[model samples]
Target chain A: GAGVSQSPSNKVTEKGKDVELRCDPISGHTALYWYRQSLGQGLEFLIYFQGNSAPDKSGLPSDRFSAERTGGSVSTLTIQRTQQEDSAVYLCASSLVGSQGNYEQYFGPGTRLTVT
Target chain B: SQQGEEDPQALSIQEGENATMNCSYKTSINNLQWYRQNSGRGLVHLILIRSNEREKHSGRLRVTLDTSKKSSSLLITASRAADTASYFCATAITGRRALTFGSGTRLQVQP
Candidate 1:
């Protein structure tokens, strides 16, 4: 009955530093996604992972953005060489399945990253 | 590129009044979903309307999709103060893994 959860509700880091945001999806969820919301970018999809397949990284703005899901349950989004433009709320969501079918996604509270 | 665009960036209404928000998208979509977020927190799924279906209702919320126009509208009847939040429209494109979201509309339901 637990919903998706994220850690470090807020994070502040210096430019050029690396930051990692964590997400724990609901039980039985086979699909996970990460999105970013900023003053300038609004809300944009960053990455997606479905089952054991390769994750979709098309939305990742640059090579510095990377994510990994361990054991198909939890995911961590890492941003290297952070820039002020990367400052935003990092949100995570999970669904029973992937884009093959229409399903509702459960979202986490999100981690607000501030690159100073 | 943003696929969906919500109209009237902000809206204000009294409790018990109805509220309506519109969304327009650029490309064809398989379905459209509405989500509500309180403050800057995580989003809560409100409703989903498929391209084949013209309209759907859940509790006090009504959603209508016009695939021909690539647009949709969400109407909340008898809104309450608790309904005050930011509403967004997200479109699921064919063969796409992720949903594209609109800028969102801020609704303030005054009690």
Candidate 2:
């Protein structure tokens, strides 16, 4: 039921400020992911957490961007010294964990971040 | 920087017509997935076709994957006005847990 939920539906911040976005995954799902949708860039992967293992951070655009999943359920994405380029809709997704089995990711409504 | 790129950046068609969109990625993938997003709404997974599958169908949607060409296509037949939205193709590479999304094709189905 509860699909995926992201908090702070919309945010406006100064260019040099920092912001944190939150995500709550569906119950029983072990895989969680973060993505950014910019004006023309579509959806860009940010990071992912599977169980308690080290997250896959290959998609993070820069060192300023970091994410963490605590208790294998809630995740937070922190953007340091935000820039106009960092403004976008942050999306979260989750799915059941497995090997070549089910990989259908349920996505959240997303949080729109605006950096001025 | 992006892996997947979709064609026809935009499409406009009348209801009951067929709409087709194509996507091409840079690297080999284990599976390809299609998603639809209405204006201001979250994305909804339409279908997924593994690399091993050449074509797959679900209701009015048809997805075809051509690994050789590193491309995929989605066809929506007898589309309704409600079908107007942005369609995206995502490719999941082998060994990676994230899926790379394309630029997306905006389809406008007029009633």
Candidate 3:
């Protein structure tokens, strides 16, 4: 009964560099989501993947932000040309979608990305 | 654009006292959920209240939703010092796949 998990608890990189954050969802979870949280601010929805369907990338701020969920389990969020504004904690969550509806999401320890 | 907004950015209370936080959203929602975060890290799911549900309870937590007002409230009864954390309200808008979160309320429970 492991929960969602993320890699690189903290990452510090220079501006214009590219950074990738990874997430491993819980077993049997068909839906996965990524969100970003700035300091003293709320979480911003980034992208979502449901099963084999297309991923929802509407919330992504720019073209540089993109994510891919491979084999319906692990997801990787990559930010190209990272800017100072991209400095924030990246959170990943997963949930089960059943006949009733989408249930509560289980979140993983976020990866704090610092663009210096 | 942020859909949900929480009131009283911060609150302080003593252990055994109740804590109540409110959230108001801009558009209609399918469901509202409460989450708690510690040390500004990952969040933990607290409760979920559907649009049709007026109120729901889990342990010491009580959540209420008013679809007409597009608002929700989370009340923790007889709180403990361990409950000190940042609370947020996230809304799943109608016809939306992702949830929009509020700016959260920092609750400080003094033991």
Candidate 4:
């Protein structure tokens, strides 16, 4: 069984440019999440999508950060006008069922975004 | 901001020794999970302890949760060099899909 997978292992772009990171969750897993990890820091929640319910975007730091999960399987995180502060590892995770009691999340290798 | 805080930010020990890391949280949780990360990449799920359970064991890993104290501990026994990595504790509160994670404990197992 394939675990969660992310695209573009490493990406370096100008601070003003936009970057899109992609994630493919495991089959039959209806819950997907995005997180950001800065240098020597812990994981920060970004967004969460469970089934057809409205996605939880409260963890998004700013309006510049946005994410979308199409067909309830693949998710794309878009950062507009990236700042140097946006440089960090973007990780995606998925779980079997997103119920409140479910705690296991399989994570992807992550996409390292570097805003130069 | 993280809801959990892990003590002893970093640790170094011999391969055959045991390593213990503690975590404290500030809110009620349905479950607590432990994850391991290598080279700052994706996290590998190690163990999950439900709120009702005080202790759980998997292989050489032991996890304990004390809802009354809002704290938990992860112990790795007879660690090997391959066990060297950053370990984090995440809390899943009731009704929330996203987890709150602690900074993590960096453990180095010297062979």
Docking class of 1: medium
lDDT string, candidate 1, B1-111, tens digits: 779999878999999999999999998888899999988879999998888999999999999999989999999999999999999999888888788899999999999
Judged by TM-score relative to the true structure, which candidate is superior, 1 or 3? 1
**TM-score, structure 2 vs. true:** 0.95
Clashes of each: 0, 0, 0, 0
lDDT of 1 at B31: 86
By descending TM-score, how would the candidates be arranged?
A: 4, 1, 3, 2
Candidate 2 lDDT, A52-104, residue by residue in tens:
78888988999999998888889999999999999889999988993342487
Compute the lDDT of residue A88 as modeled in candidate 3. 97
lDDT of 4 by residue, A1-116 (tens): 59899999999999899999999999999999999999888999999999999999999999999999999999999999999999999999999888883659999999999999
Error of 1 at B85 (Å): 0.4
Clashing pairs in 3: none
* TM-score of candidate 1 versus the correct structure, residues matched by position: 0.97
A51-71: candidate 1 lDDT, tens digit per residue:
999999999999999999999
Model 4 residue A19 CA deviation (Å) reads 0.6
Tens-digit lDDT track of model 2 for B6-80: 998999999999999999999878888998887744689999999899999999999999999999999999999
Off by over 4 Å in 2: A98-102
Best by TM-score: 4
TM-score of chain B of 1: 0.98
Position A71, candidate 2: lDDT: 89
Candidates ranked by lDDT, best first? 4, 3, 1, 2
